[model samples]
Target: MPSSVPPFSELLANTRESAVHFEMRDDYGTNPRLEAWQRGERINWDDRESWWHPFHQTIADAVARGVAVRRARIVSEPVSEYIRWEHYATHANVMAGEDVRWLPRSQATGFLVPANDFWLFDGKLIRVHHFAGDGRHVSDELSTDPGDLKLCVSAFEEVWQRAIPHSEYTI
Candidate 1:
């Protein structure tokens, strides 16, 4: 159970190590590990081409460590492009036994805010809405309430149900 007043980092530390979840159109973070999937060694942050950052690595690492990961997305051309070339399939094989769910983008409907990002983990929820031209400062929505978190989880599950199993997913 997370407290309502503490900053997100505190709540994150108290939760189980593998409980983090995110709803993003592209990846997040500035670590070197992200370079592996992106086309070039350097990422173009502001563009869609750079979307393959830490998100893929994080999920891949989580799966390798035996944490369950579920994903729902609009299945943009980029995701399929990576899948087609077997970029992720290779790492995906290491955690072959665990389940990885993929839901179509259309299924994400209302949840996909063109300029906002969503994250849900344990009982915490964080929503980041981008403002400005280069995505400088962003607005956030944070809550530890079960009801709010459930909405995000439910959205994840709805797409999960309609998604193909990892084994069958293809580019």
Candidate 2:
């Protein structure tokens, strides 16, 4: 939410038609929330009030507005612990109305994917996520280049097609 890039909710607010998130990473280290989940804390999943957070609110709002909110992650098989945590955490994302999918990296051989993670909104612009080699956050950037937009949309669609829905993917 820093720099010139807009906050994600605002971007989602402005979107129409679609908001596709394409992620390509194996390990993202750890966070306090993740550690808590790993330490045996669990969401009731049925209690909407207990886990419906602002991020989920944004996605739900978009879906209510008819914007197709989708998320696709390309990950390595025999996934990292972080990814294992993410797989569980994704239940919230799914409940919020995102059509989430997962694709193993080994099966992504013939497709093209961007070098970084990005959220392409309405296929007009993208907010790219940059990370350190060890998988720490660095910064975010916004891009509106036609070529970049095309690549992001194409890459996302290809991976999304090959990905398994969250309910179907196994660890």
Candidate 3:
């Protein structure tokens, strides 16, 4: 984590062409919504005013500016409850103009996947998310190294190609 690294919003705002995210975890235990869902507090997907958040607005703004925003998740088969909740809530992301996809871990056999989740902006910079054993976000590592950038772009594209679109994927 660099002391001068820009915030994620700044990275997204500066991105000109694309912002692709790769999520490789099955359970993001730190998500508050996951806990809420577990306790039977469901999100009213029909009410955009209630469900939409700042991140969704950011994606919408990026898309409005002609940036192609895509998010691909690689999860284990027989997905966890958290994944199912994500799958359900992903409609909000789509509504916000993001292309979301899901790929089973078994399907990613030979691909060179990165160890951590990352957002590759315009195929140039990467913000890799570091997480603890219990799936809590620890910190983010930013890199613009050519090699790292190449790896993130290649890995995301490969995963995107093999992943099923959100509308078609089922947990």
Best candidate, lDDT: 2
> Could you arrange the candidates by TM-score from highest to lowest?
2, 3, 1
Model 3, 90-140: lDDT tens per residue?
988999999999999999999798899999998888999988888888788
Which residue pairs collide in model 3, if any? none
* Candidate models: Cα lDDT each: 0.47, 0.92, 0.89
Cand. 2 Cα-lDDT: 0.92
Candidate 2 wrongly placed segments (more than 4 Å): none
Cα displacement (angstroms), candidate 1, residue 13, comes to 4.0
Q: Name the lDDT value of residue 61 in candidate 1.
A: 58
- Candidates ranked, most accurate by lDDT first: 2, 3, 1
- Model 1 lDDT, full chain set: 0.47
* Better candidate number, 1 or 2, judged by lDDT: 2
Model 3 gets an lDDT of: 0.89
Q: Give the per-residue Cα lDDT of candidate 1 at 146.
A: 72
RMSD of each: 8.4, 1.3, 1.6
Off by over 4 Å in 1: 1-12, 17-20, 24-69, 77-99, 107-115, 124-141, 145-147
